[model samples]
Target: MRLVPLDIDRDLGLVHAWVTHPRSHFWGMQDAGPDRVRAEYRRIAENPHHHAWLGLDDDGTPLFLAETYDPAHSELAAHYPVRPGDLGMHVLVAPPTTPRSGVTSAVMRTVLDFCFADPRVERVVVEPDVRNAAIARKNAEAGFVEERQIELHDKVARLSFCTRGAYEMSTPHLSPAAIEHAHRRLIAKALAEFSHERLIEPVPDGDGYRFGELTFRARRFPLEHWVVDPHSLRGPLDALGFIAGLRETLGIPEKLLGTYLEEISATLAGAAWKHHHRRETAEELVHADFQAIEAAMTEGHPGFVANNGRIGFGLRDHEAYAPEAGRPVRLRWVAIRKSESLFVSARPEEDHYRDELGDETLDRFERKLRSEGLDPGDYRYLPVHPWQWEHKIAVTFAPDVARRAIVPLDAGLDRYRAQQSIRTFFNVDRPDRDYVKTAIAVQNMGFLRGLSPRYMRATPPINEWVAELVSGDDELRACGFGVLRERAAIGYTGDAYHRTGTSSAYTKMLAALWRESPVPMLAAGERLSTMASLLHRDRWGDALVTALIKASGQTPAGWVAAYLRAYLRPVVHCLLAHDLAFMPHGENLILVLENHVPRRVFMKDIGEEVAVMNDRPLPPAVARIRIDVTDEIKELALFTDVFDGFLRHLAGILDVDGVLPADEFWGLVRDCVRGHAADHPALAGRLDLFRPTFRHSCLNRLQLRDTLQMVDLTDQAGSLIFAGTLDNPIAS
Candidate 1:
């Protein structure tokens, strides 16, 4: 398909036919005569800010009508903020003479691409009638975010926007240049992480260090962190070749080497795709919305080398569900026999499905159940990842389906976007709705990304307990620290799998939970951002944190201090004062921002990640979160998970970007921890945030040792694979 300028003289009749058709009532030109339509087109032609286009098929046949205008100069300027690069767009597919499957969606994408064809355009805006649900879905599929309903001159319109980055993300492809670029960066990361884990010790060469045939200059940080310069590296650009060359040195098991390499390949491909399609610069992302920043992040986990190894996802699945893809998805629903399923919630009185699915959807689901000769009250609704339903549940649980223990239902109406944590989803259709995290039996990082049915029962209770702790504590509440509680959970068990009594992926397949959204917590003028974006860098190696600091209008040190207080202080307080430690990684936290500076943080992934280090008395329902570990091991939660896993990467970004030196960054963190210690002197010396040295808990080591199920969640302390100790960067 292609776009050409709409000629008023030649295309007037065709355009009039499309706008006057009964299906085109939303176009608002249904009553206009041919002369009136011609006059409208003539007016649009005369207006410099507005232009029209006719989408043509291969044979030069017009299939759709498209229009572009400058929102800054159009009627939309009064409704919303019109940035310099924002361009308005409108599309109407000629009511198809012969029905086509995806013609409208394709036309919408083409018009968006046409608008963005001009390098000056960074965002595309749309204003469809609020009642135009068909156009609303089409707009969402094209990555447009509906801001709000506005009373336009013509009608009540749903004002929406799509950024270039989000559009490209929704439609991604691989490029040879991007592949080579990503390989070099991934190889550099592998070398640095492998060296840090003591898998391969690079010996000093002339100006840099050499490992096997690879050579690079790197700055060694306090925790033996290697900051390798991607450009300065002298090595083969082949990631697989580099890994194969040092297979013996890295000590990857002979049997698992190929599997590990496959993961490496997938990671390389994902990174390359991100590099190729991602168009947002650090400066532009500084002012972006929460999901925009999320979709713009290039790197996955900072410490892990094979972080994006989504093994089961095909190319189409990647486009449909990958977090970086920014594609909206509807979750597949199923009805499980209530006797065989478990539904638990923090608030039993609240009908979660009714709130999430709405009354019409609930009625439709009940009707489906009743149509199957089943009683609606006999079954419970459970949402599953579409991929999982097609790939795993349909085939593996066929027996249960035949026996009427499980009945497949239709997909939900709400559109959700995949979160950075692959299993979790954000409700893009309705921001205030709870986040639905589903089980997708795809191997990523070190485990099949599935929700354990056993854990599902305790999820809501554990989250309730943690939320209470955070809210009741002054230190946590003072900094606006909060947890997005998993308020409800549903797990469906196939009798066949249940009889086996194994904790494998099969047992974990069909479970989902609802976590409270951070959107409802925002006050006026406040925005949300993923904490991971703080460490994100653009293609030009500009750090997002640096852009944020510049935009905040605060001194570098002052900005760093503010971030530490909002994020670091609460983490330390939780550990030192409450003897509770969390996985507080960047992806697990959301930052509340005001004027581009972090004002507070909200922690998620609660039930599976939170651990009580001491032998604290707990309710039985919330007891699963308690992990018995020594004081030394407890300290690793900060040193290893926080400082080494996360801050090390952020420090490297700021240092490389020349925004803040690593020393000064860690010093601010030290001050944040010390100030909290001063507040509670009785807990001051229990766990040392500032110590001379601490154990280096190796993350890559865990993945390398076992590519599947690396850490047993129940025995988290015993499952750790640690190397020798390293100097603490925060220690005086």
Candidate 2:
């Protein structure tokens, strides 16, 4: 790789074409002519703090164009708290002349090296447009920390920095074995989830497994918990091949199958991208704080095999916005008229949002309202995912913006990190503030991942009921379990979708909720984590749960029992005592830890998920939790969701790691259930119905049947697809 000085005279034609091409939107020179290009480079040549260079390969073919500047003196200076030794950079790779697979990343790595080679530079900074997910992802891989977004003249740029130490140890080349490991891990999850979903039934064949009808055969020798070992895979370690083998058997429609394949492509790409991330030991990961550990996770859902299938995201959006990408985002806020919107709050009006929004932000919002000659009283602000605004709302919902019903407030101030659910963002900047769950019309997993305006009304009220129940009950308090309340919610009933009706994505497109953050509630020395973190295994084969056990310096069973004391007991309590069951999946539950021991849990993602299993009296406000699920299926809440869904996978992890044998682990679970029952004799009548054995619930079946709309938020439980039965592990 080589860097040649930009030639203003001779290089004008080639450089002009490069900068003004459709792909060079980041260059901010799409319409510039030769003269303008000359003026820009001439300006760069004249500036002391900035320099431009043309990068080349060994044979002298132009590869990329790069500019380096001092951030303290650049456009980004006012946005960030610029420190000494910070260098700014910009790069526009000449659109690939041929089918060069990794030329972009290769050129980026070389330029980053060139930028850091300067002895005086301690950190490298860059500001790419926030929507330019391609560069943002490349930046993330190269050890950049996304600070936030800053307005840079023409675009709202995502500000990021890479320290010398971070760049030195970050983004390693993936060995073939590492790639294979990722492939095998994700494939195993696919086998388990897809089979569980009943897309194709995998029957045990001797010591191995087989799926598909007689004509087409898909087979595997799966390990404990059906984790497909890459070596034991009967055919090529083929993700696409796996789908092809099942296409006929699963009865997948061609158009839907094609789209599903695109999502699968994104999922597989995520696995490949995980190669660049640091292969930290579970021990190292266990020590990091909540958001850090969250960002550290590479995989998505454990039970759903195609967990990382974010369909709407192109490769670039995957890098910038996917939770797995670990890049920070600055949310775009908008003001929609109150008459055309809805806002609900659990807390008192002034206390619910104003404290967090602050005078400055509120003033800015009010200013936006005033500029439109509208009263602040008639408008309620909603935060939007930047990608959704650009890719969907700006283009797809352009009429709403033009009508000034939804005003664009470019991204600034707060820095949010995407959680596993993708649309939900936790404010890492203000950890104590409410988590903003926004609407993005992105096809992820099986759903179009939009927050429904119709559903906004019940969120706060349901959360209030749960929080009050937890606070009031001595039994629940004893378990040390709490809830991360969704204090407020907002949604816009756009006129474009008014006549189209509520079922469409257009009605679901613009909505948000401010769920109470788990950060502020954390006690001193207590750290929080997603329960899903327990199932993650780093490339070195260290399970995160194992590291937590080690961190607590307790035996595996002891640690698990303590965990069950907090996590399981409350869930069971809610079931038996209140006829309530949360969705209770890993992503929906939070584990609060002290010294790596789970001390308590914070239940979240309420409203839609909190189901009433039995006939019960509920006030009109809280009645949304009540579902018509029958007695036979109610126990599946604990069985399918908790035992089979979460614990089954966790048990596999613990058993395989030799932390605790399967029987002992299940025995411990039995002990916890019995102990909880014994302690709650007053509720013996209600608890009598609870038991271990349960029907196996097929989760992916719902998605397989209808990928377009996975589950209706209204008829949440009515859509369940079931298979056979599995003996529950935690039988007393």
Candidate 3:
């Protein structure tokens, strides 16, 4: 596509038709004739601050019209503060002769490129009419953030701005350059994580370490953490080749080797996609909104090399569903026969449904059910991921649909953005609404992300138990720590899969859970950020933690201690006080930031993740959380999951970013540990948090052994593959 200056004499007829069409009502020129359109363009062409261009294809046929102006000299300058390098733009695609998939977006991006082509333009400003929902989505895809709504002379307009960097990140063309960039980063991560897992040890070389065919400089940190310098990597730089070459040493089974490599390739592709998008610097992200930080996270799981397998997603699916894609999603609703489905909740089921779906939507659903000759009260409404409904349930459960056991309903009113955890979604349309976590049947990390029906029955009760425990504990309340309880869950069991009695992803499909949102819990002047953001580093190697510390007006040590008080203190209290431990990894927690410092942390992903290590008496419905394990292995909850899995990466990040030294970081962690023990004297010796050595639980090893079923959810400790031991960094 090429941009040609609008020719008044030649393109007058075309431009006049476009602006005068009923479909172009938003353009505010429906009454304009050819002469009027020509005069308008003539004035725009004559003005020094304004100009018009015609976007043409290779054949020189006009496809779109674009106008660019200096915002300082336009109507927008009056509404918002206009910066020196802000360029105003407007684009309209020619009314389609035949509809195309991405024609408007293509034209939109082209216009952006044309604006950014000039180095003088630092940011592009747009003011599309508020009612133009299609253009709003397009603007969001182009990385334009809405600043405010302004009442213009003609129409109420949404004022938005997009920087050059943002534009480039949003429309990252999947070119050779992007692929190469992705490969380099993935290779670095593979080398670092695999080496950390002790899958393939790299011995000391000249300035770096040497493995089979790779050489990279790495600064070894505590807990066997290897910070491999991405720039120092010297190897084939092929993700598949890297994984395939280490197949023997990694002990990947022959049958699963191909799938493992496919996961690696997919991870690389995802890395590239993330690498291309997210041009915001760490400093810029310090003040970004919750969803922005969620979308900006590049690393899926810091410990896992193939963190973003997303095996079932194609290019289009990635755009529509991937968290990093920053796309809003509407959950598809399905009605299932009450006999074949289980509904569990802390609140009354009807009240829960009424609050979530609204009375109007509930009535609509009931009407739809009655129209199909099915009684509404006999069925339960369950939220289904659009992808799962189309790809899995629509076909695989057709028999159930035929019997009116599973009936499809319209999508919900709220729009949600996929959380970093992939299966969970944050409600973007209404922040206070419950987060809907749905089963997708997509393979991510080591497991197929499907919610088990039997397990769903106990979810709400387990959450209730945990919430009660946390509330009753003084230490947790003092630290301002809480759980985002899984309030409700609904699971549908198809007749065919129910009879099989075999454990498989098929049986676990078509379930959804609603977890309480942390947004409502936040106080005024406080904001929410995913705990994962602390470990996030921008493309330029600036750490978000460092930026956050700077923003907080606190020293590095002060910031670390504050964060530990909010996060680590509560985690340790839970273990010592109740023998209760959660998967307290970064993504599982939401950090409440007050003036950019972590004030409190909300733990989420309850039910399926929280484990009670001690043999404690429990209610039958909540007993699923209790697990039997030897006393010695219990603190692995703290040592393995918290210390090794989470803080190890955070320590490395802060150390590498030069904000805080690793030794000092650990010293602070040790202080937190001692403080917790001091506060709870009777429970200090319950778990040996200060043990000199802890078993080195290898995550990749488990995945390598069985990619399909990595861990037995019932027997987590039995499923772990421990290689050796790591010297405890926080042991005193």
Candidate 4:
């Protein structure tokens, strides 16, 4: 698309049309009429630091609207850190089509080309509304990274930045010359239809100059003897006569109409009502005259007046008058001298009147002005307060406080349950069933460890049941099984802990089963081997045989190898004998510990098992295996599962309850885990190995540090050392 300067006359209408287009609402232009549109373009056309243009597609159709602001010259200068050669920019796709496919990125590239082409320009910044994810994504693709999310101009805007270096690095192939050419083309088109004129006289009160009948001034200007009558000729005398006729015809109501006419005459040399063929045509002629006058006055012709249907100029150096009681004074007759000047303050009283004008009329008037090629920002007639107008461009960056509708977790759980039921009933005898079951179990363990902590303190009730069953206590087992059976029968699995088969579920269930299963002192015994084999055929026999030898406290010797060979498949035996058998249990132990431990595991329950292993005189290899497995599981329970789970739970609780101190809960978990691990040397080693992994995982999951506090675990090993703890305290 071609990028060219905006032409106040020719391109004003198009710019206005784009701005008033419903899509442009986000860009901050309300509906405005042609006259205001022209006024806005006039303002921008005269600005040296701000540049705008219409971008065209290859087919020569207008594709997007692009604009750049030198932050040093704009209000954003005060808020954003401005670089001497930096520019702030924005791009919007026109309607009946929004940005399609890569259009936004294309437009952004074009804008970047224009901005960065100037060797002096060092960076470009964008502040898109955080909720405008599409724009944010497009910005990222255009090589902008989020610097921070900040409140700018009363809106929550995501402030993103692209430095020249980063942009060059990310988009080396983009052509700066091509972007400049497009910008030049757009600017040239916008300037082509612009009207320039000389002032007739010096305006009063050092307000600049007067062009035609309109006087230009800072912030405001006065409306001259301008008449919009359907029945008068174009001369001053006729205009005066038209005014007299209007006073008589409208009956002036004797009270309100006289003051209005007197005020009009005082501002204008003479009052007149002239007849044009149509009301709209006459209004345009009056507005055009005002525009001509404004252009003549400003030093750079950087101003224009908008009449739209209103017939008065804004009073210079005078606050808008608040009449005690009467027909409302017509501010529409007021004209803004500088397109960039802030409008009259929209005080409470004025707002009542502005609102009464109705959104439709205001929208139409705004659209008409924009259609005539004006930035909505240039018009002073909009009802928005002066403060609101000053930050108009940045307003789009504001945060949308409207809460989005979120599907609660309960609903997600229900949907997961339904899907799980369908999968179970249909795929019961599928060849991958065991694999799927193992996968499901692993996923359940993860969820129990991850999600359940957020819902309840201690182990969630459901996890407690699972722990009871795996710990092999008859009363607890029966009770847990009864609950499970009841839940299954009712088709109400509480929260679908076993249903959806997510990664979290797998991790949680696997961890819980490993830690609590009563088959061996450590989960990696013959029973676990059998179970693993039933679940996964590829790794079954070897896994079983290895677990048996480990549990029996025997080293893999001649007989053990033969037994393994007899039980496992030939390929499995060969692979295990060669590759797997020599691998350390520490790594495997860590993996199993991560998969099986729930958020909370009772230390006393596992202490008895560790004691049994310590008393046995197994082979050095087998003894090491037991020590590593026990240590890893216990350490994971204390460090990773408990610590991380507590933090996640605290965050969830704070979000729901609104007043809980997360630090207190985190401290409690840390203290409990620290004490438990320190008291057990096997657990201490596990904790140390698991600490780094847990920290890394937590960092990845929680994007913000304020969401979860990190405990000081650096001195933990030193504390354990002071206590004279060793890897295997029982051996000493």
Which scores better on lDDT, 1 or 2?
1
For each of the candidates, give the backbone clash count: 0, 0, 0, 81
Q: If ranked by TM-score, best first, what sequence of candidates would result?
A: 3, 1, 2, 4
Best candidate according to lDDT: 3
Candidate models: Cα lDDT each = 0.86, 0.77, 0.87, 0.32
Error of 1 at 606 (Å): 0.4
lDDT of 1 by residue, 1-732 (tens): 689989989988899999999999999999999999999989999999999888996347899988999898989888887899999888889987853334575577668767888999999999999989988977776788988899999899998989998887663335567887888899889989998999988899998999877788888875788888887778678998888777777778888888889889999988876775576788878878898789888888898998899999986687678988776789999989888988998565227778988889889989998898899889888888999999998998888988889999999998888999888999988999999999999989988998877778999999999999999998889989999999998888756777788777788888999999999999998999999998898887888999999999998889888888898889988988788888899999999999988999999999899988777799999888887778898889889988998888888778777888888888888888888888889988987777799988888888888888789888988988878888998896
Q: What tens-digit string does per-residue lDDT give for candidate 3 at 410-493?
A: 999988999987888988878899999999889988888999888789999999999999989888999999999999999987
| Backbone clash tally (model 2) | 0
Pitting candidate 2 against candidate 4, the one with the higher TM-score is: 2
Model 2 has an lDDT value of: 0.77
From the highest lDDT down, the ranking of the candidates is: 3, 1, 2, 4
TM-scores vs. true structure, each candidate? 0.80, 0.76, 0.80, 0.24
Model 3's TM-score against the true structure: 0.80
lDDT of 2 by residue, 79-182 (tens): 87888888988888997674444567767778887888788889998888888998888888788999877786798888888999888766344446556666
List the candidate 4 regions with Cα displacement exceeding 4 Å: 97-100, 171-732
Model 1 TM-score is 0.80
